[model samples]
Target: MIDPLIVLLIGFSVIGLGILLVAHLFFMDTVQKTRRGMAACAALTLLLVGLQLQHLQHLSSGADLLNSGPYAFMLCAVPAAFYLFSRDVLLPDVPLRLRDLLHLAPVLAAAFLPPNWVAVMSFVVGAGYSVWLARLVYGMRRNVGRFRFEMFFFGLFALIAVGVLALVIALPWTGAPLFYRAYAAAIGVSVALVISVLLIYPQILTDIHEAARLAYANSTLKGVDVEGRLEALNSLMTRDKLYCNENLSLALLAEAMNLSAHQLSELINSRFGVSFPRYIRELRVAEAKAILSRDQRSSALSVGMMCGFGSQSAFYAAFREVTGESPAAFRKKQPTA
Candidate 1:
């Protein structure tokens, strides 16, 4: 019989698949949104599936080692995903390749190991890698400026707490059950959920909570009176098709609004609570959807170029940053009208 948690994992499979499908649908037309975090979520779901399978297979490997293997892969997935999500939500200038390389570390390592060493190596690497992610996340909080990644921090703390529990269970003074390792497996599932919460609908949530607080406090602060320019900004956003420009910015939007860059930026910060680039991405993503829907023969369209991207690479990065799906993958998932 399936355990309660396993039942939930099955449920998660359905939910994750649904999310991935929806994410793909929105992303295909917006060919240039962020999918790094989405990819991480999908990968984590797969990780969970693999773990469930391992449980059913009743493999003779050490429980600790077996449990840890999938987790190690997960360790890479979360941080890389976090990096992608945060970069999209916070910093546009950061390179996607940089974040991507970090996530692939485990797969890279696998090439060097003999088959028998895979289990122990996965456990050791997974446990150690998660610690590295926690430390890195703390550093990101400290260094990445004021718009912090609260989601990654949440997951990091939970993982750290779990690690402490695992250590406690392993202690000679502690009479840990041989089955206690399963407790840690549960943490693996929790980690995925936290990442999902932060990535999906983050812009909407972020807009509601911290935009006001973040607006006036930083060096990037736009200003206090934003409502005055909002109509103009909205007009420009709708009429000018600014999103079609690959390099849209606060200065540009401000220029169009007949306000100084400083004033315009302040207005966006005050009104929208997001930096200009992020605002541009959100708009661009919305536009992508319109274009995709309006044109039935989407194959005739170049998804990346049509979205105001200077290049496919730039569009792909922006798309993943915005919508959490790759262009091709998203298109494949779209429902036929």
Candidate 2:
């Protein structure tokens, strides 16, 4: 028979590693919401792993694990974490407040109660939070787009938690060892799958942050003359060659155009069908190509620097992506004068 404890331990290890990875990436500015959501998920998974270990060691029954204070906290806090994460991703401008901790009050209260009361409290708390989460998700459904996948996952997680709370309530009275183990295994598998997806597609979090910012920017530009603004933006890029400035940024460009960073981002994304960085890269690549064609003697690195690319690697990547060839390859294809 497969050792369920071993599976739990492995799952915990994977989740722990994912937490570390997310923290590292967050520090590196790789993603916005990973710091909060991934940490909470990992912590909750670790708590469940510990409970399973306790059950395996015969130190506590499944009912005992369910009734534990930490377990109660995890039951309540996990959904709250998901909600906070979604809110942060969807509405980054709204800063997190201390009031959000109120969501955990019920489970904290259950921590001091009897086992039966704890089970009942856990079920009640989980059900209420699940409904709240579903409603929140529904409100965001229109704007979520690619982030809808993440929101869906959290919704499913909340629903599963509700079911698990019900199982916890019944497991002690029924003494169903097989069902308890199955639930434990299912939780372990679900945690592992979420962690794996987070690791593999960390960019999803970054995309959500960007999307939220873009949406905010677009909302602000609602009544403005989009055509005039786009013309002004294009003039700033082409006539002034603003893209040639190595330190050019959305904020700087927005200031120049008398607009907000979000507004400028919205203009670029809506009119040009690209993000600010990609828009800048397209300009820089165009300049680099011109330089390459006109000044064949110029070194690739020097040409890259002259065209606002900070590094040869960035220049080459953008060049290849835009032109479908390396700088040198493109240059070689040009006829000698």
Clashes of each: 16, 0
* 1-337 per-residue lDDT for model 2 (tens digits): 4555745544575565456555644542534444565555455545555545544543233355554566556554555555555565556577657887786676567667776566566556656756765565555443344456667677677666766666767766665454345555656656666666555444345545555566553367777788888889889888999998887876789899888877777777767666676678789999998888888899999999998877777688778767879999989888778
> Runs in model 2 with CA error above 4 Å?
5-21, 24-63, 95-101, 127-131, 147-159, 172-183, 210-218, 222-229, 232-259, 265-337
Off by over 4 Å in 1: 17-21, 24-32, 35-45, 52-92, 97-103, 111-161, 164-267, 270-337
Instruction: Looking at model 2, report the run of 10 residues with the lowest lDDT sum.
Output: 53-62
Estimate the Cα RMSD of every predicted model relative to the unseen true structure: 12.6, 7.1
TM per candidate comes to 0.42, 0.58
lDDT of each: 0.51, 0.65
Q: Give the per-residue lDDT of model 1 (tens digit) for 1-337.
A: 3355554554565455556445543543322234654565455455555544444334234354323555335433444444444444433334566555665565556555543344334445455545654454454342222325554555665565556445544545443333233533454455456447535434333332223323323454345445656776787788887777866655566677778655654566546655555677678767776666556576423755666765655566556776778666666666767
Model 1 local distance difference test score? 0.51
Model 2: what TM-score?
Answer: 0.58
